[model samples]
Target: MLRGIVEQEGISKEKLEARQAQIQEEASKRFFESASQKASSLETMTLKSPALKSRRRVLDDYDSIALERILGTSDLFPISYLQIGLNAGQSICRIQIRDARGRSLGYGTGFLVADNILMTNNHVLDSLETALDSIAEFNYQDDENFMPCPTHTFRLDPEQFFITDKDLDFTLVAVKDNPSSEKQPTDFGHLQLIPTAGKILEGEYVSIIQHPKGGPKSVTVRENKVSSIFDDFIHYLTDTEPGSSGSPVFNDQWVVVALHHSGVPDPNKKNAWVGNEGIRISAISTYISENYVSYSATEQRILTKVFPNLKPGPSSSSQADGYDKSFLGSNYIVELPKLSEEMENDVSRMEDNNYVLDYTHFSIVMCRSRCLAYFTAVNIDGNQAVNIKRSGDSWKFDPRIPESVQYGNDLYAKNDLDRGHLVRRLDPVWGDKAQQANDDTFVFTNSSPQHKNLNQKIWLDLENYIMQNAINHNLKVTVFTGPVFRSDDMVYRGKFRIPAEFWKVAVMVRDDGKISATAYLQTQKNMIDNLEFAYGEYKTYQVPVTSIEDITGLDFGNLYLHDPIKDRETIGHVIVAPEHIKL
Candidate 1:
């Protein structure tokens, strides 16, 4: 199958030889370095072994010992080895690759590397579409009585999490949970890929569990020997067929050492195989660590679960600090919006009477009764802004607050509602701490349940226009955003009320050093009420800061004076475009 792929790709023999030579050179370098380290350890042990034991005296007579007794225990393994190997085998699965129409492409081996995460060769499930079409079949082998065991199939969810490297020949993708199945992926524990070296030495016996030729599960236990070690790969003498790609190469203790990927052809003989090569687990771990920050919030969360040590530094918000009221600048002071006297007790607050949940460059004030934020405030430094891409969504509850007081995935699951970011993700994502700010926006405290169309269209456009205006002019802007909670708001799932109207107040300093504050309101009430309908349109209107305060029961202090629409006799000015904004 590998040969067929190579032929189809039109890879020349010269190219293969050059790649082989490069691998060999790297292997040789790694071998010598490892050899030196082993020699040093051996020397130290040789020097210390004698001192640790008593001095040997010349024996007058030697007891006769049977050769069978010595040989019997020399290479013997403990009874637990079989049990450990059997448990590890459960994680191994046959990957059935298929096209869009469900036609069989081929098969490869894969194993669970983390909860709901499967590891396989990139060639087997190369792209997101391929993974979507493929399925992981567990317990595809016969039982002890030679009868076929019931198999469980799971679909790959690359949309949730997927990271692959072609050169490394490894791919990690999320597997959809199958709770109704007789056997769950969690039943078979995952193999943690340790990054440290010294799991096995060259010439040591290794083992491989694979689905060869897409056949039943099989194990070549302790028959394969590690022949060479490289910085990123290892060559081992093993009986691996085409379908063995992505198999886990294990040490005697069942610890995964490498990911089996390809075979090395015998140079002197035609159509003959010498040994197989695998990407070292340590190398894969290094690759993941280096590129972790580039992944989306969902990917990062999954990776952090797999590798706990890879979690980023603690969030600045976790320290109980509030928003920097003077973040815009010392000269331009924009204080935090104040809640009305009757609404003050409805918010969560600290011992200092501060009701803000501070993050990297933003803050939030949670509404206890609504289980969502009353408002979010952020300081945007357009000059220092970073162009971070939105890959995936993974919202988490803030640890400082009670989880019960937060509306999480349950509120938006299996619905058209979207978890809208109150403080736009890209707004606070600026300066040196951009990534932290990006992650900070994913908390449930900073999100509200919004209709899909409203969140994706005009509402989103208005946010982009405001943010882009600040960036284009290199101006610093402080924005306050929140949902307008109403007593008549619709109760969702009988748990919490979903806000129909949302509002934003953007404050910026003009060239003349005068403060310019603008307020806008958008409602998805029609969409929320008519969710069964295929389509519903939302309206966005520019309003006075005082008007927003009246509905939200919040005081913007002197921001009302800076509002350009404060003197308008009418309530709202319907905005159709950027030119329609009353700045």
Candidate 2:
């Protein structure tokens, strides 16, 4: 009976222990299954979290090789805000395209590349003729009160010197200076054009300041990365709107890298995109280098200053289109040098179909850009010297140029300067058109800003001395007078340049059939600051014909060798009075 009880007890204990072990195993398995499900849910949430992943992964489908490579470069060299001070608020101008009826066509943006030159898109400016009719408004921004700021408006130059390229879709034009003020494009500053290749790389930051959708100036900066670079175009994410057509696309350094043109879809399929395409600036530089000859030397100098790497354009003489030398008459002692290369469309034609050059005794060899030379027929014998003149005879603008371009009375107001005529009123006052020629002498283009002293004292004496010779010789003489227009002349009021020197070339037919030439040069530098005509302050030199030709860029037709001063060591003599002058 005792042995049976012990065996039963052992078997019961073993059964209890086995049951507990099985329960523990079942609990352990349930706990693990519950934990695994929670862990799986957490993993799913983390995989979808943007903050926890790499930026590359966040961009997801934008991982194409081009974008990937670009992003990689951007990733390595982080975009930085470098400059905001240099040329920040001075370069931009608001443009309005109008029709012949003064009707609004559209609005766009433009910036200065050189002094007096504004650049925009051809699509914005259609044709060269359209640009001349358009207006450029500067300081077109709102003040703190949300009121439109006071703006300066200027019309385009009548020179109508336009160079456009459809491939680049660019229009470069010359804007007129402020007619009433001494303000110039240089006062506003300009963007430095960089033509060196590889200066702009893909994945660099580009910040654009523009007048978007024809609205006030706005700037776009965030996420504005250069996505890709084609041969001539750059695709960026710079967020530009419609009216931003010609706004300069600036890099982080504020240097213009391209011109904002068109935009495309974003790579992420985010349904968020804008016009972000630009014609690379390098391409524009190429066009400029080829077409620079059409511009004036002053214009070219500005371009060269802005772009040191620029090459010279093809060589061409001054072009004066749609006009001939007949205005001066072929009966002269010799024909004036033909403006074969630098010919510009005649200002009369450029102005209107009804506008006539209507030249009388004097003619203008108008350089399409600069009216470089003026010629007048002088009849010493068959002429009446009309003294019909008034101190109040207003300086009228040349109808040939738009109001914005004419060098009118604004430059002389309150300044002791005189509007000296290239073709003196007396010289051309002999024929039936005496009054007309006298009236024409007042045209701003025909006159330069002369020091009152020099114009009254020295310059007048020289003209009188020459006219006196007309009586000694025949009534026939031809005179050509103008400024020696240098690219870097001293600026007045920041816009007009008072030429330091004036030159005159007078031709006469001697008693013998031989042609005699005399060249005169007068400088007014010492008298510039003096309001009075101080004696001994002016120097009038009877320079060699070679010197005159050298300074005026005029070919005198073998007259340099025939000058009285041709063989002198000193090309000229300083003449204070008529007696001091050598005819």
Judged by TM-score, which candidate is best?
Answer: 1
Using lDDT, give the best candidate's number. Answer: 1
- C-alpha TM-scores of all predictions: 0.53, 0.41
Residue 477 of model 2 has an lDDT of 68
Q: For model 1, state the Cα shift of residue 384 in Å.
A: 16
Clashes by residue pair, model 1 = none
- 231-347 in candidate 1: lDDT tens per residue? 788878888886888899997667788998877666667766777788988787777665543344566678777665453323345552346778768987888888877777888
Tens-digit lDDT string for candidate 2 (355-376)? 2233445555443333333333
